[model samples]
Target: MFAIVRRHPANIAWIALNVALLIVVAGLLVAGSRVSVTGYYSEAAWNWMAGQSMYDTTGTGFLYLPHSAIAYIPFAVQAHPQGDVAWRIISLILFVLGCYRFFRLSPQKSEFFNLSAGFVALLLCADCMRNGQATVIMTATMLLAIDAIRRENWHLCTWLLMLGFAVKPLSIVLILLVGALYAPMRWRLGVGIIVLALVPFAFQSPDYVWQQYEEFGLCLFHSNRIGYEKWWAQLFGMLKAFGLEVPDSIQTASRLLCAVGTLAICFVLKQKLDSKRFLVWLYTLTAIYLMLFNPRTENCTYCVLGPALGLFYAEALCGRRWFAAGSMMALAVVILGSFELGQHITPQGVPPVWLAPLACCFFTLYAAFRLTSELNRLEPPPSREAQPVLE
Candidate 1:
């Protein structure tokens, strides 16, 4: 191991940087559990073990499924600081490993690209790590599932998708999008769904499990209805900052329409591109949609798009698209600076919470144009008559 570390000095430095950041953030949380979202997970697990309802009727409490609480039991059973540190360490490892695997999926591989992209993603997500948000793990699972799909490892893909959904229900966007676009995933998705549903019953009484499921649906419903009242860092917030207030009904309709549009784009691309490129495009679209449309999207939620952006940046550099690469770097800077930017008042007289969404909007348009140009440039295969005969 020492010899290997000496051979790859850059890799060692990168890993050390991640560990240093994790230690700083996790150390802070050890003393103040109030700031970290892991408190919610711990509370939910405690409640489940005590036969109490995990769902918050007011739409502000624990938002994940009961099975998710079960997943947190190990951490919940431990005392503060220790459990918090353990959870952060696990989250950091999953995220770093997932990013490494996903970056390797790029058609062109370079150590510099991998290290730079991974570092940028980590910097952009530092706040999420400090807050102990489950979004970090959910993002990791999404990256791993995409890599699994590219490799045609359907069994692993199914488990990863299920784990993502259990961590954050919003992951349904990626789950459904991938299932619809890939034929091989259909049956595996069905089996995974069944297993996820049945797992809760095995641990708890059927009556209790069924009741929690019912409350889970209601919890989501209430959350969606009230989500607009807060100052979100999503499309609605971006619009409202400009004096255009969207009603709750319009918000719901817009989300549905965009979901359909995403599926249509994926279907078209699946036929035009190779399997690997198509998977990357699918993940990109899913990540963008989640950031812009998820009703409760917060600034920290932008972590979901960090890995996708990193992949795009590396692709631009490999293909010699200097302009595109520069744009990606600029977007990363904006995202890293968004919290600071939000401190100053904008021309609209509101804090610039809209900065991240605006960047996402530009990225969406740029990605569409790039995809269209690539498709137009693709050369068609020659027919047999047009090809020269071989001796």
Candidate 2:
């Protein structure tokens, strides 16, 4: 192990940094610092274990499906501080492994690229880790799922995607989008969803499970209704920052159109790009959409974009695309420094909520241009017979 570490010094340093962070976060938790949203998750799990309702009307209420609470049971059962620290450790390990796998997906890799991109991604998502947000696991699962797709491991892909959904229902966007566009995933995803939905029934009484499902639906509906009435750190907030107060009807219409448009783009790219490129692009597009369009998107939610940005940055550097590398670096810095930058530009340093959406907009436009250029350069396949079989 020491010899291997000496051979890959940069990777070892990255690993060391993650270990240091884990220790710092653990110490903070033990010191009674309220650094995580794990309390809400623990409360929901406790409520479920007590055969009580997990849903509430508060802003910080548990908004995930019934299975999510069940999934949190392991951590929830552990005592405070220790439980929180353990959750963070597991999350960080998964996140680091996921990022490493994503970096491997690149056509070329080097010590500099790995170290630089890894550090940048960690910096971009540090707050989310510190806050013990489930988004960290969601992001990690999504990265792993994409890697699974690249390898055509359908079963693993299905399981990883389902795990992400079980952690945060918001992952349904990626689930449905990928299922619809990837032919091999369609049936596997169908089975996975069915199994996931039924798993709770085995753990609880049928009536209780059904009742929780109903409450889950109601909770989602209430959250959506509230999401519309309030401005979140998404596209609408970005627009509001620019003094463009779009009407609710228009916002609703725009969301529908954009969702459809995203599917359309993915469909086209599926036919033209290789499986690996397609999967990577698919993940990037999904992450951007979630940040830009998800109704309840918060500043910490921007962590979803960290893996994709890190991969892109590394790819740009390897390919000698300085402009792309700079753009990605700037976006990551903007997101990581949004609080400090906002103080000078916005009132009371209210961490410009618009910064993330703005970065997503630029990324989307650039990605579109790059995709269009690549598509135009490729010769059309003969009779669609040359396409690789994903299964």
lDDT of each: 0.84, 0.83
- 247-296: candidate 2 lDDT, tens digit per residue: 88988898888889999989988888887778778888898889888888
Candidate 1: 10-residue stretch with minimal lDDT? 1-10
lDDT, residue 106, candidate 1: 71
Candidate 2 residue pairs that clash: none
Model 2 residue-pair collision total: 0
| Candidate 2 residue spans exceeding 4 A from truth | 1-6, 348-351, 379-391
Residue 94's C-alpha lDDT in candidate 2? 86
Question: Best TM-score goes to which candidate?
Answer: 1
| Per-prediction tally of clashes | 0, 0
TM-score of 2: 0.91
Model 1: how far is 344 from its true place, Å?
0.4
